[model samples]
Target: MTTRNIESTDAAGTVRVTWAAANARRLARQGLTAPVDGGPAAVTGAMVGAHAQVLSAAELSVALRLDGGATRESVRTALWEDGSLVKTFGPRGTVHLLPSADLPLWTGALSALPAGRNPLPQSVRMSGEETDQVVDAIADALADDDLTVDELTDEIVGRTGTWAGDRVLDAFQTKWPRWRQMTHTAAHRGALCFGPNRGRKVTYTNPHRLLPGFTPLAGPAALAGLVERHLYAYGPATPQHFAKWLATPVRWAAELFDRLAAEGRTERVEYEGGPAWVVAGDTDFPAERPAPGIRLLPYFDAFTIASQPRTRLFAGAAYERALAGGQAGNFPVLLIDGVVAGVWHQRRSGKWLDVTVEPLPGTLTAARRAELEEQVERTGEILQGTPRLTVGPVSVGAHA
Candidate 1:
């Protein structure tokens, strides 16, 4: 079925919708309208994965979606103690919290991406054969035990060669071991994942140990499944949006979407003023207008990062205030109803948390102010603090 088959449209066959209605449907689908009754794993699955570049924010992202009063501690327990979630390099080669059960699909799809150009000089870069050796060595090294970076490097050098451990690659003002460049690749191949921290140091272990018998699904099928999941979570989106979200080439994403459409797994629809794709039979818009609610989503929250048609979602003053250089999620957003209306910042001291909100001029009403208070309280609860709200200029820089 396509948008043509849907009711209430213009003569052009486009299912024209208000931005509010579209955003409301997206919010409901993302478990933002109402908290879902499931644990962190379920919430993580729904989001595909929570961005974990900022671990605390990632925890809060999952906690906020849960029905039971879950906190950062709850998410931490799931990751380190309960083994329900796995920390690994996900889309865009950044750390993410993924459902441990779903690692196969993530690994397969991510590994299938066409290799990006290597920035490292040839003197430091490994040959394809050497890279494979390092990856296999990493898997073998972590198969039986977790290892810190230093320990893992030793194991890799012993298993492969001294060349693998040469500190030649420039990183932040220091040099990193040559083999370290393939860490994300190892994760995408289902061979490595984060281990519980040892003191203040991070460690790596084989994902097979985390999920016994874990094996990545074959690439083609896994990539198709990932596309379906993306459409479900952030649908009525364009191939360009998908390409950006996955850090893949637009040509690749466009071709994949075409294949899905050909197979009757997806359908094209007119969203905003452009063509977009959604999962077949999943194009129902909300009948009721959205309530004037407010939400304070943290930096790099999955919803803020993954949602499409940024121009519409970050409209008016939001385009200038909330975004950083045309990028979303650089600032914690103040979402009114569904679209971003403001930016927010949180500073914690002792047991008290100070939240500063800067909404677009004339956007906040008394009702919305009350909703903002409630959202601040919820944010405090998720962070285990007492919230103090300030409705004024948030004088903090992006990602502060």
Candidate 2:
């Protein structure tokens, strides 16, 4: 019988389909909060954020995907070949680092949408052209001066108008760098700083801008590629899933998928009785293993978004709905084998790192408990034996 018939697709069964997916999806991922120094989280966050911890552009490409620790060959190959992983201020304007090659295509699609309109009043607002001018003004100012968002916002508002408080500050200081960083980080092959001055906090920007020379692909090609990549990375997924991921209209996602199949960039796959698309790959079957164990996952990892009908991976009934809502503010999940067994949070208090978890329904066996302890030890090692660390219970539930 095919592995699809089984409730749990183990490591052996999954490897053939995609090797990285298995390594990426641990039994239960560990959690670390701000001030919890050391560990893969900080490095991973920085790489994906595309700032500080500089590596050769080439090394950055592979490192973003956790391909290998910073290496000249791996990073360079990713930059030249696959495109560096670019973090887009995407969807509801949240940060997402995606494959750099997709930037031009993604941005073009985004520009076609009606601008959501800045909420500021007319006197305070700049026309589209003026907004562009202001962004240009800010960029040019930063070309020589790395002013903090506050500094930049103050200067720009002072130069152009008043009322340059929190909203204006956020737009210039926070949002601008994040949006531009995705385009300019790798494009310029340099960093964008929080302030114009050196030694200030650094925000990563790709070397390129979204408009003009990036010269996005035409509509058909752009939409097609977007659909293909989405399915390629997250498959056995529905149009609704793609719509949410891309923040595109449901109809648009459906149309794009149809176009991809028509173009042969994707092929339809079966999930239960439903139709889903997958990028054609030589691998078959997910890795094989039992359904019980411990794994820890990161925030916004692809594993969490690949399929809308998460019941394929999550063992419980309400697991999908509950987690999706909670994800808006919290991450750091705990898994028992293949199932989402709990949720966790971490924070640093002085020298101690406080970690807490709320388990999902189901009793964790003694062996499973032991397995969890070992994983935490491994996380401690990854953090290079931090100042201090502790994990405990806050509130946990099991979704039967």
Candidate 3:
């Protein structure tokens, strides 16, 4: 629904949203400290989708949220055995483990969004029509069976012609055929989803196979639903943040935010940087705050990726060390008191997980130190492993 315009609220009045409060609100809203009890799907739903570029990271993302010390085995069982979660392309063409039941909202909202502006010059660039053709070809080719990237590429080129294969994307200091790039667009179009792995190879399948009678959101009706969900999880947000999170153009994101406001589903509020929007009646700041705890967030956790501003995430030099490229997926972060306090790494050997924490040159209280131990123990329990920690100052900055 195209909303006329947002009602004027002069929101940045009376209620002051300090950066710390914004962070705290987000921490509570994301179900980080107090995860919902509906199993992995619930955690995934709250997160929108857990980044799965590295599969284990995705599993831990859910494990840390569920009750009863959920483990990676549970995530595996849910995906491979239970069919409750499906891996697919999320915002920015990245792989994410999405709740199977929510495919309609994801595909519908995603497909409606704009494509990336490829200004890579003609030699390596693809035209808009070519991209669309590739997306359609993929949807048709994968109608029945799962296909590896090679198999899908062959089918796609066969249908769309060899020109579709001529374009290229560069990564790891090497140029690769561009056919793989269309996978995200294919996913956006509901044409492709991750199939169970074949040995060491990753494969793509039709999401409909897992979600019977699945269909893209019947227009923006689904997108409107997603807007509500996004705001609920990461409200007090600006159009730019939503745009970045969805990988949609800023203009398009702004349009969606405006539509929500026009519908009275959202209201303006005074946020740290500027005025922002939140789900209506969400102005209840300090609503029964959840006590803060230590959490070790995996790379690209939705919590880190959702909001745009980082001032609240990091205080000073910590921002530079934690987010050098202004990207969230670079490394795992340590969350203490609802802010990024350090970085950590895990090495699992047999039944024990060797954890190394590198803080931002600060000291934890005696209580916090004990709490950190408890948190590490919990992390081990969630992974179904034991914790052997090496706690000391270490360099874990983005590049380090």
How many pairs of residues collide in each model? 0, 53, 0
Q: Which candidate model has the greater TM-score, 1 or 3?
A: 1
lDDT (0 to 1) per candidate: 0.86, 0.44, 0.78
Query: Per-residue lDDT for 1-400 in model 2, tens only?
Result: 1243223244433322332233122221111111212322333333223322223221322233342232344433443334444443444445444445455665555545334435644545544554454555455545544355556656556554543232421343543322222222212222222211236454332225322245555666666655655554445456777777655568867876777667767655555455665665412334454354565443444444344455544546435523655342134467665546666644456545455555665646656676666655544333323333234564533221
By lDDT, is 1 or 3 better? 1
TM match of model 1 to true structure: 0.94
How does candidate 1 score on lDDT? 0.86
Q: Number of the top candidate by TM-score?
A: 1
> Candidate 1 vs candidate 2: which has greater TM-score?
1
Alpha-carbon RMSD of each model = 2.5, 9.1, 4.6
| RMSD (Cα, Å) of model 3 | 4.6
TM-score of each: 0.94, 0.62, 0.89
The list of candidate 3 runs beyond 4 A from truth reads 1-16, 166-168, 171-175, 287-290, 395-400
Number of the predicted model whose lDDT against the real structure is largest: 1
True lDDT of residue 176, candidate 1: 90
Which parts of model 1 have CA positions greater than 4 angstroms off? 1-19
